[model samples]
Target chain A: MSATDAEIYATRSFTETEVPMIELKGVSRRFAKKLDVAAKLARKLGADVKEEVVHAVDHVDLRVRKGEVVGLVGESGCGKSTLGRIVAGILPQSEGQVLWNGQDVATLPGEAARTAKLRRQMIFQDPYASLNPRMRVADIVGEAPQVHGLIKRGGFDEYVDEQMRRAGLDPAFKRRYPHQFSGGQRQRIGIARALAVQPEFIVCDEAVAALDVSIQAQILNLFMRLRRELDLTYLFISHDLGVVEHLSDRVVIMYLGRVVEEAPTERVFTAANHPYTRSLLDSVPRIGNRKRAFATVKGEIPSPLNPPSGCHFHPRCPLAFDRCKVEVPKLKAVDSLHRSACHLNDRA
Target chain B: MSAPTLEVRNLCTHFFTRAGVVKAVDDVSFTVDRGKVLGLVGESGSGKTVTGFSIMGLVDAPGRIVSGSILFQGKDLATLSEEEMRHLRGNRIAMIFQDPMMTLNPVLRIDTQMIETVLAHEKVSEDEARQRSRDALGMVGIPSPDERLKSYPHQFSGGMRQRVAIAIALLHRPELIVADEPTTALDVTIQGQILAEVQKLCATTGTAMIWITHDLSVVAGLADDIAVMYAGKVVEYGDVGEVLDKPLHPYTHGLIGSVPSRNKRGEPLRQIPGMTPSLLNLPEGCAFRARCPRAQADCVQRPELREWLPARLARCHHPHREEAAAA
Candidate 1:
């Protein structure tokens, strides 16, 4: 079968499942100005506010089913990291709700305490920055379990040893500091720390981007191995489409703080409906693939502070028309389980 | 064929330290034709950047061009005095750094930096220099070029700052420009735009360029010719398509195969084993022998970059052509 036909078949097979493990409904987060008490009182009394708010995470909707890895791909400062943070419940949403296993996360009493118990962990982009410089590998990996009270008294060392081994790290290296390890080794420690709490869901935010190509493969394979062994779910965020294609079961393409297209991995790769998605795929240089033409997208991404009035991608899109510039395109289904936010995809 | 625009012959750049000498660019040689782009691809510490620096006469104290000659337009730049080299630097040659901030001063406005650049090279009025600066900014696709000129470097975004730096380099219309990963930090869209602009400028003005980057994909699209650098030397040099399609050196083949895009999905990436050797303690004979998959006893003798084909060169005793043709 052709790649497109296989993609269609795969999309049709994905809708047999029910409700997702995690869902975000119209989630929007804006950062408020840091005002002093007197300034805050003045604003409360109807005084003029001078500071500007940053709309970091605009209205976004997404869902990740149980045991499925969802990849969120976008450039830096496109709100991929912000959305990931909101989904992980590390940051509070200014508007909208996050449903975790059919329950509103914000409504839960001591939400932080509850999420901590639920075992939703985030692996940061830079391993060097995420791992504490002064702390040894043993304490860095062991502290999560100690804080969550997962291990019994005097069993912390054994627990740390087990986690390190599970992450394919040498147990002896636990005594070494973060500075003593290479880029890949430090990332393994980061993974070991995340797994110590036995989290079912992980948010890997550009986990392997900072490492070399050889080291990247090692970490990616380690992640895959850990996932199968632990039955973990992942929300993988990265700018690299190649890495995402290798890891994700489903993929969401984001542009300027909003999702532009989302579908099963095969469908998105083979038959992307959105113009932006198609351009991005074409930009990736492939070896021994002479049939594919290079489609260089014109113009730079518009600044988020003053975005376009209608479709954010209309500025650089070659297929953009008057309708695209005036009306915001809502994401609609192009086929079963395949959705895109471009007006051209609006068959109706 | 016409003579190459810039011919680097046995160029060896070294850093003399208290411990020992660091052989950064050891006996590296290549040539670029007029209006052509030569991509120097390598991993960090491969000495690609140092080679570009050596050509521009930017090597600092304690680190100098210990031997060899850099012939630009038939003039040996290595033998020129500091004053003569300084005159040639911004006038006849230019360089774009990885970090735009390194090329730009945070305290100065865009117009001030660009106008000063023009006035330093030529006797021109401030208004004329400002006009030339505005044109340069517009050429690089910076919108509202005049308004952006009044703004400081800190005011521009990362990609925009890089565009401004590139624009500054283009003001003099130098015969050759050595760009050292200037677009590595930008997004793919911005990178594409910059590459297109650079290619257009080169084609229109008949200027030569050396684009030094580790990104093989960018080189595939932007470079006319490619030179794979390893252990402070060019292991292979040929047309971009020829080298990428049929790499002569084993190291070049491994480098191309290691990219994630080339491998099958879910398959383990093909990587060259072992880390880059220390420049201060390089092994004798072939620098890549430690990691080469096809290393043999004959590799113990150092191989020069001899012609494997017409206009193609490789420093490997066993080029891929013999094996493949024999098969």
Candidate 2:
């Protein structure tokens, strides 16, 4: 039942003429305020309840071509995960269009919707939290394919075994509970759960952030191997710039709720346009740049609820000018595929 | 060099669990010199944090230091009474945790906690203690120290709260500090600032430091010497540059090689195979044998930490030395 060597290392097929697998047009997600006990009491007493909103993702436009690995890099509260979820159809955007395979996923019919749901899956940051503790590894990975009717009623064990092997997990441990596995193994189990449904697109939201450095490498390798074997596309979201650079074909940098820069991996590293992007690259601790003075941004990330006027990065950007204060910088192409949102880039 | 600020030798700490004994830290040894930093680098469950706690005398029940010497100023801390350890701890020796909330009481104001920290160790007036607290905050780059001191822990940002904890640790001008992943929760920009301040403080005050973290990149710049821990053992130890640039042990080598910065974009990572062994039941011989590519039949017997090069030590039977490894 284990995956054959050929099956594990199957060559991925990509064509230049293929359309983007996922697209986000003017997407924004806003979460409403939750009332505390005091606030609830106040509302019961006829006191006005304030309406607070967290603009997690704002006016984002992204495209993921078939078999592409697009990295979405940002600090906490930058809406990287929210945007990823919106693309995966986990969260309905407050405003905008999420087109999957050139059609809006929201408008898909019953059969089409089920297929779309199975074709795209989400892999969370903490595998321990994502996996059900009560379920054995066998049920965790095998249940989805069965519910989706991808596997036969009696062929569950073989299908589960094959998925676990593809995810670098031993089929022998299928009977063990989620708690019985190590962090790396738990992550593999999560991946197996995702892969069992034969998904073509994955939204990996900090999937390797919780693992040890050595274990991080193992899981990252498995992810890369799976992409080739299954021809899967990924929207890899993480805060680690170096990791994003290592694993991605394109890198997109987000500040506040919007992407400040998007470019091919090499060009973004070599000749970055946005000041925020430059500082982010500089902030990373590299072995080659030993004892180099840290070029930290001036302040912490502003509250996404009341983000700054115009460019959200203008407050910390060293190159901020008068034009950056009143006018929001539009994403402009620096090269054919490289785009950056900055008033300075407009001047350049 | 003058006498080291702290020296740990043959340290073995274990936790008695229902399943079995967890050898959290076993026969680990290292030293931190005056005004220098020693980075204790490892992953979760690698015993890096336990080693710090053992030195600070902070390990709670179910965990005990079985045997070893934690020599601080030529004194064996392991043999010291709880009261004696207390006098040395927080006064001459301080520790910082990964979470700032672990050190700070959420209900207390910043000034009250810091003033108490200074007053607890020294015979100073309230005004003098407050002044010292302000100076400590300023030293760590907190803006408007007096104003910040008035606010509570919740009012300050995550990075600022950590800085406050560090300020309290520095109030007494402690000779040694053990910081366990203090910057792991902060953003990259904030992490940079904190690392700079800590490095500067060590230089100016002649305080030695043991920074425990899982991030190797942080150690590459911050530490004068590095100790790579694996399954509660000092698998490799030497100058940071020497150990990282030309690591002898396969584990250390693989760790550095796996980092994204080390690999070219789009190229498959040269990942070390297998996961870290469980502390409760590690593999026989070397705990890392299951993952190490160079493991041989010789590895069936445990290898002791030996000097592979001058001042550089490694615990491996077949280390990748520039010259042939001496048997």
Query: Which candidate leads the pack in DockQ?
Result: 2
TM-scores of all candidate predictions against the true structure: 0.90, 0.94
Give the per-residue lDDT digits (tens) of candidate 1, residues B120-226.
99999999999999999999889899999999999998888998998999999998999999988877666766777787888888889999998887788878889
lDDT of 2 by residue, A232-280 (tens): 8899999988789888877889988999998877768889988998988
- List, for all models, the DockQ compared with the true complex: 0.38, 0.54
True contacts kept of each: 0.26, 0.59
- Sorted into a CAPRI-style docking class, model 1 comes out as acceptable
Q: Highest TM-score among the candidates is held by which one?
A: 2
Give, for candidate 2 chain B, the lowest lDDT window spanning 10 residues.
B318-327
Error of 2 at B232 (Å): 1.1
DockQ score, prediction 1 = 0.38
Interface RMSD of 1: 4.2
Pairs of residues at least 3 apart in sequence or in different chains that clash in candidate 2:
none
